[model samples]
Every structure is written in structure tokens, then in C-alpha cells.
Target: MCKDKIAVVLVTFNRLDKLKQAVEYYEQQTYPIQEVVIVDNHSTDGTIQYLKEWVNGKGNFKRKTVLLNENCGGAGGFGAGMDEVLDEVRRHELDADWVAVADDDAFPRKNSFEKIIDYYKSLSDKEQEDISVLCSRVVNCGKTHINHRNRIKQSILRARFMAVPEEEYDKDAFDIDIFSYVGTFIKVNALQKVGTTNRDLFIYGDDQEHSLRLRKVGRMQCVPSSVYDHDRPGLGERKIGWHSYYDSRNHVYILKKYFPIQCLIMRCIKRYILDMSVFSSNTQQERKLFKTAYMDGIKGNLGKNSVYKPGFEITDRKD
Candidate 1:
């Protein structure tokens, strides 16, 4: 036997083809999933209708779907997905011990679930109970994706809290301060304590924020043996859209909420350099987007920006 039952919470927006592929990968997992909650972020594509038709009391796992009224971005969609899973548990439909986070475009390898389950079995009882999040090594385009684990910088003076050195992934299991939502396993107990992911973020920095909170409740580990693949093609309207705004805004929100005052003070001088280096853009619309985002972030104004919808161009026109 299986001592643990895992559920998956996946959120998608208009990527029906990728969603189908991800579902196929999930079906191939050696370790069985008890339930799967998929949130469709009001895709203009036929995703909602397809999901409705596809989930007809078939497949090895119990399926649940949440169709949103608006496109709530990854952050909101994930929170909604978690809510659906919790609702199913309340209804006694399933008892899920672990919640695996995933996206439409990314998926675990064939033996990914088996590897994670094996690692979980190897841990001591105390360690197993104390582990809040378990992350798998993720690769994209033959390169090690560092988002699986982020080692903390561990200093109040540092503006940023993480340093993602790819070399740190050689260990069988390593302690990590943060784990990305993609390809990570979270304990239901931790969710009961720390709460579901922050939906107010609406897009970016949501994973890091949730990870930091979960760290306070229990240990997070990255198991190199468990690997997943995340190959997000850097194209489409999503590439040219409002992510830059969310990136700048959510970064500031994270800094204010988690960083020490000493770090905040240090960031004062480095903020401009940071912006120019990472967020700098020549387009008039892009510059304005950054400025507006930075302002809202500092003022604690968050959530989906009314003007900056994904796949839509942000223009300088006042009318």
C-alpha cells in the first residue's frame, strides 16, 4: 500500500491543446492521483466546453472543473482550483493527502509521481509530516530549470531573498526556502494552516509569496530524483501582453510583505538599478506600464489591473 493519496490542482487559460497533453501525462503517472481539479480561466477558446464533455465520470481519478466568469490569471485560477478540491473533500468525495500543483503547458515525466512517492516513503515519520512542500527537478530545452527550488540569500541586506544556482540540484533531496507552483507537491495540512495561494496577486510572484508562508509551517524539499518538464514556448499574445506590469508590481508586493526593513532600506538605492536592468523597456507603452505597476505595488494596490489584460495591447492613448 499506498499511505498517501495525492490530488492535482491545475489551472489553464486558452491552452486546450497543452491541457490535453498534460492530462495524458497525468494519466501515465505510476503513482495514482485520487482527484484532479482543473480551473479554466474563462478561455475564449472552447476549453470550458471541452472540459465539461471530457469529465464524464471516466478516467482513474475523480475530476472536478471550475469555470470562471473572467480570466483571473494563474494566481486566481489556482486558488479557485484549490477551493474546488477542498469542496470535494468536504463533500466526502475524496480524501487527498497531498496537492500537486501543475499548469496546462507543463507536466511531469512518466515516472515522476513514482519517484516522489518513493522519496516520501524514504523519509522518517517526523520528516514526512513536517515536509510542507516537495519540489521536483524541472527541465526545459535540455537545461535545468531553477524554479523548482530557490535557496534563500539569508541576509537582511540583500534586496532579493533568493539565489537560484543550478549547481545546487545535484543532491538527492535538498532543503529549500521557496518552491515554484509548477511541479511542486504541497501538503494539505500546510494548506489548512497557511491557506491557499494568494489570489490577489492575479499573476506574478504568487508562488514565492505562498512558498515563503508555507516555509514557516513546515520544511520544503527538492527531490532531484523526481523530474518534470516545463517547456513554455515564449510566443503568443501572452508574450507581448501585460506580464511586464504584473512582474514589476508583484515583485514590489513581495518585497514589502516579506523583506526585512533593513533589506527594504538597502533596496532604496538599488531599486532604480534593479528596474533598469530587469524591467527596462524602450517602448513608450512599456515604460508607462512599469511606472504604473511599481506605483500600485508600493501603494498596496494589487489584483488584476483593469487596463492590462493578457493578449491585449497596452496603448498610450488616453481615449
Candidate 2:
């Protein structure tokens, strides 16, 4: 097994049980990770205390965990943790070959890191240098199949039209130029060259934006061998409350930043038409939220106070 030290950074808000499961999986990995940094986003629950106790229970790995104060959103937490890692690298306090960003709700297979190390080692120096981000195939918990459409859409949006077809997706592990932050293992130097997560995004679209920037520096690969189980529902079922706000606002934000106004208009038109076609058979609330969010997104008032604002904080179960 390659003994390359890796800095595993995780961000969590609540979901202590899910976070514990993720950490447990990390502890069972075949390859060695140098350190684990958990950033708690001001959970009103005793998540921090629970994590500290769990770390203490792990004999050798106990000393490897570090907890941070403050509830920076996922994007901000990643930026802060990466900054710490880079500082440690600069001071020679750490000599990690890679940095893995893991979501608190995600768990990788036991041999996931082993596979990553082997795949990384197989690459030539030039190929490694040219690689920006290395991503894994993520399966939702309890599901056997992959969501190819979601993966394709995410990859294309991140690459900003630099993506290739599925046939050309992987050319001997040297393919496309996009990746997701969740369950991703990135080269340290590549991140340094491309810069860290955009704190402004707070949460959504930050990964896509960072991956897009990384393309300017090097290539990104989606490794099918390294698999992780993400404990999140499908986007369609998961869409509710503030998730709608972030999704709609960020879509508009991305369009405004990267596309022409005419393109944005066309995209909005296409989106609503598709929604109307598909959602017409769905329940009234689903249709209402979908329409409202889409209209607010196109009007560039997605994040502003409106009728949609009241629904932003309502849990999906209640809605």
C-alpha cells in the first residue's frame, strides 16, 4: 500500500449519526491518511462533543483528528480547511501527496483509497502533473445503479462545455476536465495552482466553479474504480425548502456569470417548459414550488424575500 499521507477534510452541519458513519468508514480504509479535519457548522446538537469522543476511542487515529469552531457553510469550511492544509504544507509540517474532500454524509468503500493510490501511482509524472482533480463514482446509499444523467449534467456544467461524450469520458483514466468536491481526492499542487473553493458561493455551485478554474491549470478525471456511497436522495426528491433557493439562485448566478443574457433567457424558457411537461403529472405543491422557484430564478430574485421565502425554511417532510 502506498504510504502517501492524505489530508481528509470533512464538513458537517448536524447529522451526527451520518457523520460518525462516514468517519468510521474512513478509519477502516486500507491506505493511511495523515490527518482528518472536521469542521462543524455550529450544530445546536452535541455533534462536536460526539466527534471528539469518537476520535478519542480510536487509539492511533485519535491524535489525527482536529475540530474547528464556527459554522461556515460547506464551501467556506472547505476553503478554511484547505487554507490550513496549505499552510501546513508550506511550513513543512505536513508532506501529504493528496488532499481528499469528503462530505460528512458520504462513505467510501474500504479499498477506495487503496484504489486511488494505485491508480495515481500508475500514472507517469507528466500525466500526474497534468491531472488537476481525481473523482470517484458515487452511488447513493442502498442503490445499485448510477445516475448517469446527473453525472453527465454535473460534469458538463463544471467543465463549462469542455466535456466529452460518455464514449470518450475516460481514455485510460486520462479523460475529461471536471470533478465534484464531494468524495473527491485532488492533487495538492493542482489545488494550489487553481485556488481553493469560492467562499462567496457559500454552498451550491462552488464545486463546479472550482473545478472549472482547475481546468485552466490541468486535467480532471472521474475514476470509475474508486467508489463511494453518498447518503443523499435524488435531486428531484431532495428538492425542497432552502435547497430550492440555493439551486435556483446558483443556476441564475452561474448563467449570469458565464452565459450571455440571451442564452440565459433561452435556458430559462427551456427549463420551465421541461418542468411544465414533467411536473404537470405531479402534485400541486411540487408544481407550485417548481414554478415559483424557476420564475424567481429567471427574474433574478431567487434569494430575495418573496412568497418563496416562506417555504425556504420549511422542511421537505412538512411540505
TM-score of each prediction: 0.89, 0.75
Residues 1-319 of candidate 1 have per-residue lDDT tens digits of 2367899998998889999999989988989999888889999788988999988759978888888999888899989988777767778887988899989878899888888888989988987878888888888777787755787774748755464677777777888897788898988878878888799999878988998899999888888888888977445544334888888788887877888767655664465555434454435555566667777888889887888867556544331
Model 2 spans with C-alpha error above 4 angstroms? 1-4, 54-70, 142-174, 233-240, 259-262, 269-319
List residue ranges in candidate 1 displaced over 4 A.
Answer: 161-163, 234-241, 273-287, 312-319
Top lDDT model: 1
Error of 2 at 214 (Å): 1.2
Please report the TM-score between candidate 1 and the true structure.
Answer: 0.89
Displacement of residue 242 (Cα, Å) in model 1 is 2.0
Error of 2 at 172 (Å): 5.6
Each model's RMSD to truth, in Å? 3.4, 5.4
Q: Clash number for model 2?
A: 1
Which model scores highest in TM-score? 1
Instruction: State the lDDT of candidate 2 residue by residue for 1-319, as single tens digits.
Output: 2245688888787788898788888889888888777777777678878876766665324234445555556777788777778877889988876789977888889988887777888988787667767776666755532332122233322313333444433444545544566668877887778778876566666676676677678777766677788888755655456666566656666666655676567666666665444534434465566667666556655223445432355444332
